[model samples]
Target: MKILDRYILTSFLKTFATVFVILFFIFILQGIWLFIAELAGKDLDAWLVVKFLLFYSPNIVPLVLPLSILLASIMTFGNFAENYEFAAMKSSGISLKRAMRSLTVFIFALSIVAFFFANNVIPRAHYKFINLRKNIVQRKPAMAIVQGQFNAIGNFNIKVDKKSGENGEKLEGVTIHKRLPGATNTTVIRSKTGLLRSSENDNLLQLELFDGYYYEEITTKKPAERKKVPFAKSSFSKQVMNIDLTMLNNNDMDKEQIAHTNTMLNLKELVYTIDSLESNYSKERQSITDNITNRINLTLSKPKIINPILDKKIVDTTEVANTLAERDSVPDKLLALFDTNEDKNRLLEIASNSLNSSKFVISSGQNQVREKIKSINSHWHSLYEKFVIGFACILMFFIGAPLGAIIRKGGLGLPIVFAILIFIIFHFINTFGKKLAQENGIPPFLGAWMSSFVLSPLAILLTYRATNDIGLINMDNVLLPLQKLAQKLFKAKSKEAK
Candidate 1:
């Protein structure tokens, strides 16, 4: 390798490493804040918390990697240009493109690595992160019953004075406060002892209480009876109740319900999932249509003449004659069939009921279809997102390297400012596109790649200007209009004075 390429690559790598670490740590802190619920007061050990963060950390790389490359490239090149190293290279007959050759190769390789990382490592990490969070409460429901403090599960607030057993399932001196429906009153229960039990495969967390008393405050509407506060008391020898662990751990813990979410699947898995979702969605839509069609067909095609099951032929013949066949008078004739007002009212009532029923069916079907579309769209976005991550690396590098040369400033000052503004735009566009795509506002392909498509031209323009050593913008062209406006105002002011 030439001294120039080696020097350039080394400089970029040093800056990239520094920028990456800082960004990565900052984003990881944000992730901790996001999952603070799963970490705090859950009685998780140090190793568990570390694993949680480790699993979550890979998800942050998508946010960190591109910004790091952008900032690092800008700072490295800005420093070179600011220090006149670029000028020395130009004087030595090396072009800007030639100088960027080594770093370009590096960024391209980094992009590919980013793609595979998203396809493989990040999905696995996300799967683990979700499972760890769910399993913390699911696999160990006993953790919810902390001793000496009130712990809330569903509607029951339980406080245990002491816990002693294998897995801390036994509780002594238990107090419970339960809230009744409608927030009308509160129920207080005291037990001398209790036990919490849960099986590995069970969805219910069981609480068995021994020697407990229940007390509830009651309310009455009558003025005379309002003076004395009514109350109810009950006692039981052994009370056992089951609390759904699925609710306690959150609905996401249900493996059957959560397996199809976009974050849990890799590329191949996503392809299969998306295909299945779309197929099912189509079938469901068709089924709904067919159901409505069959209902209409049955109602319209029913036999007008009644016959006994034992008889092969109808006893009486029914005939319908068209009183008014003209299209314009068809509505009047249809209304005329209900000759009396009472019959007309009954007919209207039946028609209203049918309308409402049809409306309900259509509305429900629409909502279900929209939900399916969103799920399908989410999977599609994830499918293309694996490639987007890789392309983003190259996109950011091109943008940053040329921009740094154009601006000709280094260190944490101007380069950082430009990097932040540009990165913010990139991130915002990416998020907006993905969100819009998820809602089926645009195609998934465009949404996933919108940010890259929007910024590619800017990268090309910057690289061109930097290669030619042109200023960031044409100062003369921009200033001429402003200068003319100022002169026109001055001339008008002079004429008014005259």
Candidate 2:
């Protein structure tokens, strides 16, 4: 290897390693901050905490690696340009492309490594990380209930406005919803103040309440009876309830029960899962369509009449049409359909209920379709993200190296500023595109590659300008337009004054 090539490679490697380690640590700290609600005051073992962070660290690599490469490339090449090394090379006839040859090869190799890491290592890590978090919640059930949020514990959903005391055992304004089996209504229990207590020997958490109320809406199998809105209510000065905590002590921490998440799947798994999901989604949609078709295109058959003289039933062909056309609409029209006003009212009531039920079914089906579309989009996004990481390395390097050469600035001053601004733009576009894709606003392919498509031209433009030894921005070209505009405005003001 030539001395110049070796020197450039070593310079970039040193800067890259430094920047990567620093950024990796910084991002890890941010992760800790994000999950502090689950981690803080949980009394987790030190080693368990370390393991959680270790499993989480791999997911941060995709975010850090590209930024590091961009910053490192800019710093290295900017220093070369600023320190006259590039000038010397140019004097001896070494062109910009020739200087970039070795670095480009290195980046290409790095991109491949990044692809494999994202495909294999990150998925496994994500699987483990999510399992670890779930197990933590199971082992320490108290930690699952963060302040001011509804949390499911045992058979009820519990929420508290405030939790005080050293161990957060004293609660104020506590509310609980206990749902009955196979029922839609919930029994509500509310308290002004509550106390939580437990012991190591017992597998139950006892909740003691003061100044509470118990309210439950009575439901019945008959819809007519249920419309009366019957309810049961009572007041209590104090009450004690025992919530079982045996499930929290389960020893299945190593079990991979949450493997169906999108992040846990690789290319092959994603393909299989997406196919299965689409098949199921298609069947569900067809079922809904058929139901709607049946409801909308319903036809009433002719009524049968009894003939006392012949002692046989006779079909009244005009019965349906005559009944329908008797009145303008609804209850009045049902007069010919039923002999009594009471029976006619009943028929009208049934029709109203059926129409309402159909409306509910259609609304529910629409929501289900939207949710499935989002799930499919998420899977596709995950599938493409693995490849995007690798391409990003090449993309960032091209932009950074050329930009550094064109600007002729080194160190952590202007280079750092440029790297940060460029990276922010890249990251923002990536997030926006992904969000749009997840919501089905755009195709997943376009959304996943949006940032790359937007920035790739900048890389090419920078490389071209640097190769031809053009300034970062031609000041004369920019200033000429502004100068002419200012002069024209000044002339206009002078004419107005005259």
The clash count of every prediction, one per candidate, is 0, 0
Off by over 4 Å in 1: 139-258, 298-335, 339-342, 481-498
Best by lDDT: 2
**What is the Cα-based TM-score of model 2?**
0.84
Q: What lDDT would each prediction earn against the true structure?
A: 0.86, 0.89
Q: Write candidate 1's Cα lDDT for 1-498 as tens digits.
A: 888899999999999999999999999889888878667756667887888788889999999999999999999999999999999999999989999999999999999999899999998888877777766654456676778989777677889999998788899999989885579778898999999887656778788999988999888898677678788999999999787666645543324333546987888999999999999999999888877777555543546443344547645422322322333455645668777999988988998998898888878888999999999999999999999999999999999999988898999998889989999999999999999998999999999999999999999999999999886898999999999999999999999999
Which 10-residue span in candidate 2 carries the lowest summed lDDT?
A: 299-308
lDDT of 2 by residue, 123-174 (tens): 9999999988888776766656667988888888889999998888899999
